[model samples]
Target: MTPRPGVREYVRLIALGRPPVGWRTTDVTTWSLARLAGRLIDRLVVPRMSRGTLRRILREGKVS
Candidate 1:
């Protein structure tokens, strides 16, 4: 199955440290500092995640 669009775009944008032209933001949802921080945590702190596991965490992270 294909990956979630935003999540895949997010990973690429982060790896590049800037969004490509096609990834331009709109009025409804602009990328922000907090979002970058969250992505960093997702990439660095979260364990290697399969699509199913990632979706689970996206829904509710490590509930304890």
Candidate 2:
């Protein structure tokens, strides 16, 4: 699977004043400080989910 871009990349893309093609913003206040913190949490959770999925696949011979 392709790696998802991290929060830093997302910030840089927004800083450029143009979100990359296909970008979607779920939060209404994309530039808010709160959004940054929320994204940080999201970044942390995503890796754990990926690792869990990988472990499941390896141990069970298929992802659950």
Candidate 3:
């Protein structure tokens, strides 16, 4: 089955940081600093995320 997103999936959007131009995800109604933080915490419990890693992923992230 497709791993669909729920209230929990918004966190991946955090992994997204500032939304990578053409990037998109599921289960979203708005954008707010507080909301982003909440979603990141609500869904995927990313223990530690670094700016450098985020930057690298932005550079090397796979595309279809």
Instruction: Please give the lDDT score for candidate 1.
Output: 0.44
* Model 1 C-alpha lDDT per residue in residues 1-64, reported as the tens digit of each score: 3345565454444544543344433432433444534554555743343545444434342221
Best by TM-score: 3
Reference-based lDDT, residue 26, model 2: 54
Q: After superposition, how far is residue 44 of candidate 2 from its true place, in Å?
A: 0.7
**What is the alpha-carbon lDDT for the whole of candidate 3?**
0.41
Structure candidate 3, residue pairs in collision: none
Q: Each prediction's Cα RMSD?
A: 11.1, 13.8, 10.5
Deviating ranges (above 4 Å) for candidate 3: 1-42, 62-64
Q: Residue-wise lDDT of candidate 3 within 1-64, one digit each (tens)?
A: 1122442243444545553343243545444444444444444654443444434433343310
The candidates, ranked best first by TM-score, are: 3, 1, 2
Those runs of model 2 whose alpha carbons end farther than 4 Å from true positions after fitting are 1-30, 45-64
- Candidate 1's C-alpha runs over 4 A off are 18-47, 50-64
1 versus 3: better lDDT goes to = 1
- Please give each candidate's TM-score: 0.27, 0.26, 0.31
> Worst ten-residue run, lDDT, model 3?
1-10
Best first by lDDT, ranked: 1, 3, 2
